[model samples]
Target: MRVRPELRHLFAAAFGLLVGSAASACGTDAVGIDACREIESARCEATQACGATEAEAMHCIDLYRDQCLHGLQSGQEPGADATARCVEAVHAVAACARAGAATMADCPAEPLVAAADPAAITPCVVIARKPEQLADCAFVAKPADTGTTTPSGNDAGDAAME
Candidate 1:
């Protein structure tokens, strides 16, 4: 499926905060601290599950973990607000994954490519936190403009129950 250019950039960049640029498979809102921890744990767990065959997912998340967290808390960077928002978005994505709604494997080939659609490789990027049980994951993976150009917003809060 062809992803819209602007949405692609927005989605990719948000996910990029974790996995790399849109180039790699990689969020919005503020979730609780528990949700943040759960997001990280869930991502690592799913990536690990892909195992040896999916080294890309595991390595990418592992490589970016520290930097991603640091980016949020770095005084020289975005600061605590950004950190909270980022952590929240991360929690939303991780929550989606744990529910078996998405994974790193959803990313297409050449995931690290900046132009790649995060919607494809990381369904977590677009997955809704509303907890719908529809048979099709279309709504889950569908990209909705959350009025957030940055990696922070109420997207996670609106979509997710947390």
Candidate 2:
């Protein structure tokens, strides 16, 4: 999902803080900080390009943390190899999005469309089912039978879904 433009700054700040913490814990210097920032920037680019939310962007960064910051502590060259890995990671997410779009398109829209009040489905659930269709999903309301029950913020069930 496209993050609100205003929230982009929050994402950047959060990433910066994450990098700073990681760097400080490792006793990294200015160069290391720069490298970390570069990695975070690449992550942000991938997230935006992939239409991912801030959480998704953070998840992606966490997934590839090892490769993104490998050998930084030793002052060894953060080689092109690591950069290539970052690119690959971004492509992987893009591929998944494409696949999700295809799957969603092929899915029987009957279930979704046949609902008495299709306006009642949460955007997050729809997005989970089809990440690429997040924009389209946003306008879809939940079914009448589903009720307009917003889960408590603390509910983690949805997050654990495949």
Candidate 3:
């Protein structure tokens, strides 16, 4: 899934803030051993703020976080790494979109389709890495806690606004 253009700035800003406060990309707390927790937190928070559904928010968390941690260096991460991750995450989302995946909301409106074609989706993903372009899951794993429901917001129309 692709985040709306306006939301990308918000997501990046959130990432910056998380990095600033956390002081370390991977804080070795009592949580899981994953080193990219902070990045995942920032991405998911931004996704929620930008009006992504819980599922979409989780999807963004998984993709970007995995991309960040995958073959990552040990210390403060580089933006280039994230940018590359965004591209990869977007590709996963694009494949899902092309496969007619289910979505919580309508995808972005292109010329005549719900969202940009798979070819265009990558560039679009390159633009907004938040990943909410599809209505359903292609490669993204479902959230573990589906029975619990947080109060939803107006994220249902978030993609269409793009």
List TM-scores for all candidates, in order: 0.27, 0.27, 0.25
Candidate 2 C-alpha lDDT tens digits along 1-162: 899987999999999999999988986332333344344445343443335666765665554454434323324344555544533443444444345533323333312333223344332333233221222211212223454322211111124222
**Candidate 2 local distance difference test against the native:** 0.39
lDDT of 3 by residue, 1-162 (tens): 999988999999999998888887565432221424443444354444334567876776666555543422323333545444533443444343444534322233322123324444332231134233332211121222543222211122234312
lDDT (10s digit) by residue, model 1, range 1-162: 999999999998887675654434333232233333333333443343222224554454454454344222111233445334444444454545555545434422212223233544454443223211111112112233652122322122222221
For model 3, the superposed segments whose C-alpha errors exceed 4 Å read 1-35, 71-162
**Which pairs in model 1 have colliding backbones?**
23-111, 23-112, 23-113, 23-114, 24-112, 29-153, 106-121, 107-121, 129-159, 130-159
RMSD of 2: 19.8
Error of 1 at 145 (Å): 24
Q: Model 3, 155: alpha-carbon shift in Å? A: 18
Report, for every candidate in turn, its global Cα lDDT versus the true structure: 0.36, 0.39, 0.39
